[model samples]
Target chain A: AQSVAQPEDQVNVAEGNPLTVKCTYSVSGNPYLFWYVQYPNRGLQFLLKYITGDNLVKGSYGFEAEFNKSQTSFHLKKPSALVSDSALYFCAPPSNDYKLSFGAGTTVTVRA
Target chain B: EADIYQTPRYLVIGTGKKITLECSQTMGHDKMYWYQQDPGMELHLIHYSYGVNSTEKGDLSSESTVSRIRTEHFPLTLESARPSHTSQYLCASSEVYSSGGAETQYFGPGTRLLVL
Candidate 1:
């Protein structure tokens, strides 16, 4: 069973500042991870994914994540944050049956 | 953008009313999934289909039933709606790549259901 954990429940960042959302995984073999964002009353939108590729995976809206095998982490990062970036983010890894095992989710608030 | 879509963006119904949530995808994806989520919360997979007529229950125990009569359509039905069933329903689809691995699911706007 592959699982992901998001340590923070909420992250607050000022506009134009950097933003980071941390995620750690527990898996027996190769790791395939994904990041998604959800706006209020909307379904999740795909951010990015890592599947046997480069450690640094870039995603939508100028966001990127660093895959650290040693640390067992895939953390989402953005160089500069905007108020519109505030949303709920999730880190998910596929379980044995190809179903996504999603994290508890982290709420991000980018204040203007 | 993803080609998946869900109907009835918002619904408020009385308890014991039977309802069906419709989901469709035009991207010709082989796999489709239905998930239940509360506002600002994590998603819980309720049902999924590998293809037409191949529906499976997910990790969460749901009172809803799903049917995949067509490759592009997967609809979830609740025999009797209750307050506990009030939540947003999300539909997603993904294709298996040539590498035999599926990743990066595309999602719909989701249907918000409120059972009074």
Candidate 2:
């Protein structure tokens, strides 16, 4: 069994400011974590992933995520946010049966 | 680039209307999935395919069914769509290469369905 949680339903940030969307996960074994972004009425786009090694993983659109094993968290972060970066973000962990389980998703609203 | 495609980007139909949502991926991925979501909210898996001629229902008990005949095509059909079925349908395919059991999935634009 694998699961992910994005506690915040919505996050607001100003342009050029750093933004963080928190995520946490639980799995019986090793977890394969992922972050994805989705524009309005569009499908999910892969952003970054945490497979192994480094805890900090960088992704598309100048986004990055930190994987904290002790905290069991993989939080998405951006050094500088753009208004265009406002979208829905999802956290996922591949389930034991090869299915990917997704979080409820967090909507990030970047204001210019 | 991911070449996954979904037909009927938006569909509006009355209750009891039967419809099929088409999904095709050119990435030659063996695993394909169908997810039902309410915009930026929760996602529920409806169906998935391991390969051609291999389809299975997902954790969510759905009233729809899916078929995978060709490697690139996976179509979902609803015998009678209800108001509850009015949601967005997203299709995705994954390739397994990364470590720690990571498999990156590429998604299609998705089908927005509304049942009247």
Candidate 3:
């Protein structure tokens, strides 16, 4: 079974500052990872995914993640933060069999 | 943006009442999934369908039943709603690309159900 862990429950950052949310995974085969964001009372919105490619994968909204095979991590990052970026973010690892294994999720607060 | 949609954005129903949550996708995806989400917890998969006439239960033990009569439609039904069943139900869909083994899922706004 593929599983993902997000250590932080919440992260607070000032607007225009860089922000990062940590994620780690355990999978048997080649791991496929994804990042999603959810606003209050809304379904998750797809941000980006890493299928197989460069260690660095860029995603929507000027966000990017670094895939470190050795560490089994795919951390989401943004160069600068916007107050609107505040939301719940989830890190997911694919089952490869089509099922989605998601992390508990981390709440991000970008203060103005 | 993702073309998936879920009806009854918010519903308040009493216990023992029968309710159906509708999910539809305009992207013509081959896979559709239903998930139950609670506050401060990870989303739990409740049901999924590979295609029309195919449905499977997910990891979570859910009393709700689902049917996939058409590729675009996958609706979930609860015979008897309960307070325990009060949660947000999310619908998502993805296309299986022959070459790419990883399928990216697109989600709908979700249906929030409150069973009183």
Candidate 4:
């Protein structure tokens, strides 16, 4: 089963500062990558996805992820983060048959 | 926001009680999924359905069972709830392409279950 790995358990960033959350996946051909965010007491929301072409995939809330095939990485980045961006983020790659294998998640805390 | 919906956004129940988590989507998506997630943790897929009457177990070994009798509804049931079963249940739906691959999944407000 293919899976994604998030090296960071938590990330702290000052509001208005740049933020990045890193993820790597176990490779299996051309993979589809996804990023989802979960706010407190809510379900996971779709952030963005990478299927093919364009290495830089942009998604909701001013977030973008760079897909690096050589590094097997998909890193989510934001030029400036807001306090409202504090949430749990997940990087996922679909396993065979289209089931998502999610990473252990990274909690982003943007403080003022 | 996705049209997917989950009922009883929060539930607190006693051990041994039977509980059902209801999920419905207005998107008419062919692929639906149920995932178990602890607070601020990773998501574990428990069940998924390709379409009506096509339920499949996911990588996680869950005590809960799900049924897909209709394209719009997929409900998960725990015959006897336990403290271990206390967690958030998320419902998601996605459209299937011609190649049988799925696109991005849209989720509903998860149902949080607490069994004491």
Best by DockQ: 2
Candidate 4 C-alpha error for residue B45, in Å: 0.8
Q: For each candidate, what's the DockQ?
A: 0.67, 0.72, 0.70, 0.70
Q: After superposition, how far is residue A48 of candidate 2 from its true place, in Å?
A: 0.7
Per-model TM values vs. the true structure: 0.97, 0.95, 0.96, 0.95
DockQ of 2: 0.72
- Candidate 4 reaches a DockQ of 0.70
- DockQ-wise, the better of 1 and 4 is 4
CAPRI-style quality class for the chain A–B interface of candidate 1? medium
True contacts kept of 4: 0.70
**In candidate 3, what are the lDDT values of residues A36-107, reduced to their tens digit?**
999887899989888887989999999999999899999999999999999999998776465877767999
Across B1-116, the per-residue lDDT of candidate 2 in tens digits comes to: 47999999999999999999999999899889999998668778889898999999998899999999999999999999999999999999986564535789899999999999
Model 2 per-residue lDDT at B8 = 94
Using alpha carbons, what is the TM-score of model 3? 0.96
For residue A43, model 1's alpha carbon misses the true position, in angstroms, by 0.8
Off by over 4 Å in 2: B97-100
Off by over 4 Å in 4: B99-102
DockQ score, prediction 3: 0.70
When sorted by DockQ, best at the front, the candidate numbers are: 2, 4, 3, 1
